[model samples]
Target: MTTSAILMYVDVWIVLCFYGYLLKIKKRIGFQLGMNISIVMGGMAALLSGVLLITQFPFHFTVITMISTVAGLTVGAVFGLLFDYQTFVTGLTNGIIIGLMSPMIGTVIERPTMFIIFLHGFFIFSLLTIFHSIKRS
Candidate 1:
């Protein structure tokens, strides 16, 4: 298997282990904590998938990045839905924004820039989710 594929597996294991620990301490984590972790996990998965796409394609790099971004957003939306309704809205919004900007902003093969964009999306979505949750309360 490719290195990126291997890294994906490793990331999945890490997330699973971390969530398993959270499940053990769900009482302490509470809703907000769980929500934050869910966002982080979704974001990290997106970043990793972006990296994987880059590593695998390396050519037609722009298209690959865009494709990866779409894939990442799809995954994030799925995770958000699983997490909660607010997160679902946040993820979908974030994904749509990022997917639209992917072609324009990070067209080059700069991993750092791509990561930053992914992180930006993560933070924005998290903030929106939090705000919505707080408003609901």
Candidate 2:
């Protein structure tokens, strides 16, 4: 398939898998860790979605921003729900702030393909770190 389609699929797949994995370990984590996880997941997912969507639909800036923001907030809220109310709110707030800004970044960046590559690496790195922390505790 095309690059945008591949990136979109990768985004959806990673988030879904991550959500499933979180469900398995929710009982073991505390608010602190939960908040961090939500923050990282929501922010990265929003950013990536915004970039991917913008690259695919260059003319629809506002619509893409809204879509990405909702995606981030939903992902964050779900992740945070596994822990506590406080965690949920924390995640929701972070997701909103980052979501609002993510589209702007997507619009300005000159080299999206390279940026997407680096972002996926960073996102995976963060997820691995969270997984390691969970394993330790």
Clashes of each: 0, 0
Off by over 4 Å in 1: 60-83, 95-107, 110-137
- Over the stretch 1-137, how does candidate 2's per-residue lDDT look in tens digits? 77987978978898899889889878888789889998888788788888888888888999988988898888888888888888888778778888888888888889988987888889889989999998987
Indicate which candidate wins on lDDT. 2
Please report, in order, the local distance difference test score of every candidate based on alpha carbons: 0.56, 0.85
Report RMSD for candidate 2: 1.0
Best by TM-score: 2
lDDT per residue, candidate 1, 1-137, as tens digits?
A: 87556755765675566546544544544455445555555555555555555555555666766675675566556645555677666665565455544444334546744565565466457546644554454
